[model samples]
Target: MSEQSPLDLAEGDPFGPHNLPYGVFSTPDAPEHRRVGVRIGDHVLDAGAAAHALGSPYAALLARPTLNPLLAAGRTAWRDVRRALTAWVTVPAHRPDIEPLLHPLDTVTLHLPYEVSDYVDFYASEHHATNVGRIFRPDGDALTPNWKHLPIGYHGRSGTIVVSGTDVARPQGQRKAPTDPAPVFGPSVKLDIEAEVGFVVGTPSALGSPVDLASFEDHVFGLFLLNDWSARDIQAWEYVPLGPFLGKSFATSVSAWVTPLEALTAARVAPPERDFPLLPYLDDADAEVPGGFDIRIAVALNGQVVAEPPFAGMYWTAAQQLAHMTVNGASLRTGDVYGSGTVSGPERDQRGSFLELTWNGTEPMELPTGKRTFLEDGDVVTMTAWAPGPDGVRVGLGEVTGRIVES
Candidate 1:
């Protein structure tokens, strides 16, 4: 990892020597079987094959069909495996043997890297929260009294979480219009996308003990692009007392490749200033990446780039979210996903979801597809991101894209 790869690497390539993200893939020749692979440019280095050749201690772990084996192995094992892979790819002497194992990205199919155990979506962005409050709670304050005090979040269903490229079937649920006397059951009309960043948990914590702020990196495996697809109308109708159910739980698409957090060392930045003093449990103190990451993300609807929601603008950082989630004695499990909900910034163009950008369907976005107040049946949403890499390089994040199909 210290030296640049002698292999051909292009400018603005996200999978340079510095950012070797991991995933699972299968070729058409072996469609029934899948194995671990590491992304490098347009090629995928078959981790199972590479590890076997290198005689790495983690060879057996890397050979698994999913990443759960490597994830179950602690942080040190993760780093060691990454180092071994990096050395094999970058070192010129090893290329002769490794080149044959490399597979073209297009020639293979990517699968969900791990089994999602639990999912939690946090309303960490100030701009997004304020917009939601303004749209829904118009006569009341934009932010709740305890909004700035903690990282607000709710548990999500992991069973419905799908990998990238999976077609999201528009969900059917009861949605009551504001003017309607009774709720009607039908397919959602206000289906939307929330451009968010996802943190993957690798190491597990105990049942009663809490994970502190400084230990966030120790448990977190990596990061990926996540689209928390929403049924805005359904959410509006049912999220009054408890929170989102069918509206938010139907489908969520995640990118296949997960970039190791170490690759984003240079992208770390202090989170936006907090207005209220944080409690001792939620306080930010000594840590590796103090506040959060500056992973630049953009939202595209039907191939049109509409927003550049800022990840660094989140009022609460990922580290804080981890600390807050475990403070109440909840144990951390492998494949647990923590979503940094819709990353809207202060500017109008930086809004993350259609509800905010179009002002709750009042202002429509005139795109190549047509005037879109919300997602139509054929609408496709894609999210891509870049994080600062070493030596002034920009590391690319794997993208999550999904096309909407009728249920």
Candidate 2:
């Protein structure tokens, strides 16, 4: 838990001083350039401007309008900036200088916080993996033979990763019917959203070195909301030999704010125990500060809460995922992003996606709008989450939201 900032936070506000999530924003008055800022209540403190005004190194770094500078500065610098910002607001002598940089949240335009160099999506949730496997292949095992041993992930298209509120167009791709001999090309019919939590890599690693579990906080910047939009029908036809491509790449939306990893101390939990024998790399993920978080996530359809996907339900923790990703000697970059795929739990209401909740459309979800198996045109899907905060309060992670549009 972190110390509270003196600023008056809103009722149910997740953007307290402990959770001063960072992002980039611009207003119509200053549309030509974007500024790095932190969220607190209804206002955004222009960190870049504050740093510039205070004559700090963060000012120069934040001048570029992205979080890459601060992210690349490493742990000591991140903590220093945090403390400085806290003092700027909380300390009476410095408040006058910092107060001028604050802007109303509603008046600014939020943009993608960083420039993503690469993207990876991991299938770490046991319930989601099992439910998806059972529905897609009822006759086969619910999980793969090696699922318990390793974190399964795939490289996602970083170019198409959009910020929240960006419209998602129904993807057009090649699809072949189960009985058809020919492959057909058309717009996707089965569009779904995967409620995910993304981890941003702040520091880069050498090409040949692996990042161990203990070093997670040192290299990772923070967590943000993510929605890896999937085109299920297209994926089904093309995923037999190679993994996802177009079906998964059309657009993946992320939250405007990136909550620092430091704020989630109270939210940390021990990940589930592994059933397999000891592997040298993945050893003791449950011991001392495990990577799992007690983030309560809700998936809403047209403003109605449809499901509550549990982040704690994840089988493989984020620390393990980071280790596995870099164990193969894959290098990291400043803006690299990775996500926990489709967080789900044992219950039906805890399902993350429509595919699982509706059992691949065989059963439909009863919503106020109507009975829905999947999203329809104009349907809005929003994912929001809050973790245990200091003083038993809750810290908000903001949200990742998007609406389905016609092809």
Best by lDDT: 1
Predicted structure 1, TM vs. truth: 0.97
Q: Which parts of model 2 have CA positions greater than 4 angstroms off?
A: 1-6, 10-12
| CA lDDT scores, all candidates in order | 0.91, 0.88
Off by over 4 Å in 1: 1-6, 285-288
TM-score for all models, in order of appearance: 0.97, 0.96
As a whole number from 0 to 100, the lDDT of residue 113 in candidate 1 is 95
Expressed as tens digits, the lDDT of each residue in 302-345 for candidate 1 is 88999999898899999899999999999999999989999999
Residue 74 local lDDT, model 1: 81
Looking at candidate 2, the ten consecutive residues that score lowest on lDDT are: 3-12
